[model samples]
Target: MRLNIKITFFFLFITKVCLAQDWMQTPIPGIGNIEFPSDPEIFDQNGVLIYKLENDDAFYLVSIAQTDPSYNAEIEANLEEYYEGQLEGVEEASGGTVTFKQDIGIDGVSAIDARISGVANPELPSLLFKRFVYVNSFNVSAEFRPKKTDELEFTALKDQFFNSLQLDVSALGSSIVVDEVNGEKDAFKKGYEIGYVIGRIAFWVFLVIIAILVFYFIIRLLRPKKKKEPKATASKPVTKQKIECTNCGKSNSTEAKYCSQCGYTLPRD
Candidate 1:
């Protein structure tokens, strides 16, 4: 009886291990494979590829779409704006308020991670965790909506779903490049491109002008000032020397003819 019990326990343990490692790999062309906890329903809607999986506790979704060729540079330059738009769209669709948001990167690719709470639903109020990744010309999204936010299993599943996404860098190297000359160009789009370029150039020129003005003012402030010199004054005139009269023994001017007190004539030199 004891031997039979030991064998049954061993078999059960082996089965549990196999089930734990039963993640399914779903391949996405031009991107990479994502490991789903179970087989997900895949479909295409309006040129966007979508994969969905649902269980009693939570729902999982993955979406992939190719971006318009003309807006590649704009999206790359303004990644934050693109992310904000995506978050806003999610909020509007689910009627949820974004509770947490973070900027992240996967395999050197920029991404945004956000959480939404207070989603309005008649059946159950749901919590959503979403990740938006930009891979070259493709926009990849992964989402998890759990029925119960406080459950440990749901949290672990959320982490597993997000982490299982693998991007193949080798496939991304041969990216699709659209030749604009061969395609029809809209006049409005062309004008917008020209205006955007002009705006960028004008912005840089303004910044350079501001920098030069600031440097000039700083130089003026730090430079030493020159000192002023004192003015010259006029000199006083010298007085003539006086002479002594011999007879009166009195002093008189050098040009005097005689002494005034004695009435004697002055001797000529």
Candidate 2:
């Protein structure tokens, strides 16, 4: 039952991806329109269409991926619809896999355009890659690189995709040096601009307040309570209290045994 539920969710996830996303032309008018190629699930492979827009020697390649909601479990039921009624290829049961088949499209005629494609070993939440291969417009021997990162590295996927890259092909075209690559994402800068700094400050202040409250509670819970000091009973001062008896006109000392002037017994304490 649990396995059925998991599969059901996966199908729902695929359905969502198929239903929500529609191919639309992006910018630059109708230089190109992408068609959803037959979504085929190859056995251990993912694919996507890459469209390159080149103007004045500046090229921007955008990869369009078509696949079931591998990331979502809601629309797994519609996975077949995304595949156009095709089943996914058999894969090792140890790890889950989703496949995508892609067609690269470059609009218009390029007198000279160099291109490359390749897969990459993933690091983390980064998109999985295959490799990168370079080819000249002339279809002649161009270049191929398997390395992920190096100075003057040709094909590498770092962070998000970047568009502003300078193509430094010498006049002779014997060597190629790609420089002036722009548009590397400023994740922190963007986050900070959107009040990340303020959020961090608020978080720290909240933590400090929590710490102080915790310490106060601990000390309060641990410290011994006083016995109220027993309220030091206020001592009454001894007041001189002399008395005279009317019967004998006798003057008596306060708390005296008898009056000295008369042989009369006085009230004594």
Candidate 3:
């Protein structure tokens, strides 16, 4: 019927309208070593990454390494995101015969000043590739060495790429800056620091207040309630009944005398 069709269309329209109101665009900013940076100031702009790994093995190795603490689980997580972002994007994805090294910052905030080089060729590669991958072409410098080589050491560095203790940045530690110095606590900046401290204090106070209120309500509920006694009502007079003792085979208290068969006393009497 025309009415049903109109009603259906109306419902569909209402659903779409509600959906539009509830719609939210979640932008998953790719995290980790390999990623798609959308900042106009970086890369080829247009957020397009044209690089591809010529070395398939190196890509896999880096992917594994990223999961280790050093890479912040970005290799696996970021590559997927990087590749995903590359797909159906303003950029074309390619990874072959290309190598470069670059310092990567997370969301342009915290930075890691290091080189990332991916090489695939292995007619005879050095022992360095035992821990890191050999990529012929990467974004960062291939020959960049560390100043503090012996600062930390890892025995199982080769076995696990996503090790948190192997001079590897973990997903948790890499991008998160929990213990920060941002207050007048630093003699360098007083005004901003004081404001920050105030804000932090307010946040903690709010949490404590909420916790206290929750406890109060819980205690109020757990407190025992007084039970009401049922009202007594006058009814009928009760009647008594008698029974026999099976062991002695004697009858007692049919509201009567003891059994003549046995010398048992009457229960009711």
Query: How does each model score on lDDT?
Result: 0.76, 0.33, 0.32
Residue 188's lDDT within candidate 2 is 26
Each prediction's TM-score versus the true structure: 0.57, 0.30, 0.20
Per-residue C-alpha lDDT of model 2 across residues 1-269, encoded as one tens digit per residue: 45445545665565565443332222211112222111111111133333333222122343333323343343333333423222121112113233443322222211122222222324221222221212221111111222334424323321112221112222213221111111111332354346645755765675566556555665766689877665678889988878775458777777667677776777644
Highest TM-score against the true fold, candidate: 1
Query: In model 1, where do residues sit more than 4 Å from their true spots?
Result: 1-16, 123-125, 173-269
Q: What is the Cα-based lDDT of residue 79 in candidate 3?
A: 46
lDDT of 1 by residue, 1-269 (tens): 45445545665665466447645666665677677776677766777778788877688899888887678788989999999999999999989999999998888788989999888875644788999998677899999988665768787888888888888867863343222211212333465467657866766675566556555665666679878888888888998887788898888988899898798987778
State how far residue 49 of model 2 sits from its true place (Å). Answer: 7.7
lDDT tens digits by residue: candidate 3, 1-269: 45445545665565455333311111111222322111111112232222222231222122221123445445534543433332222112121222322233333222222222232234312122212221111122111112223424322222222221122223223222112211211332354456557866766675566556555665666689889999999899986765785548665567556676666664542
TM-score order of candidates, best first? 1, 2, 3
Residue 240 Cα positional deviation in candidate 2, in Å, after optimal superposition: 8.0
lDDT at 1 for candidate 3? 41
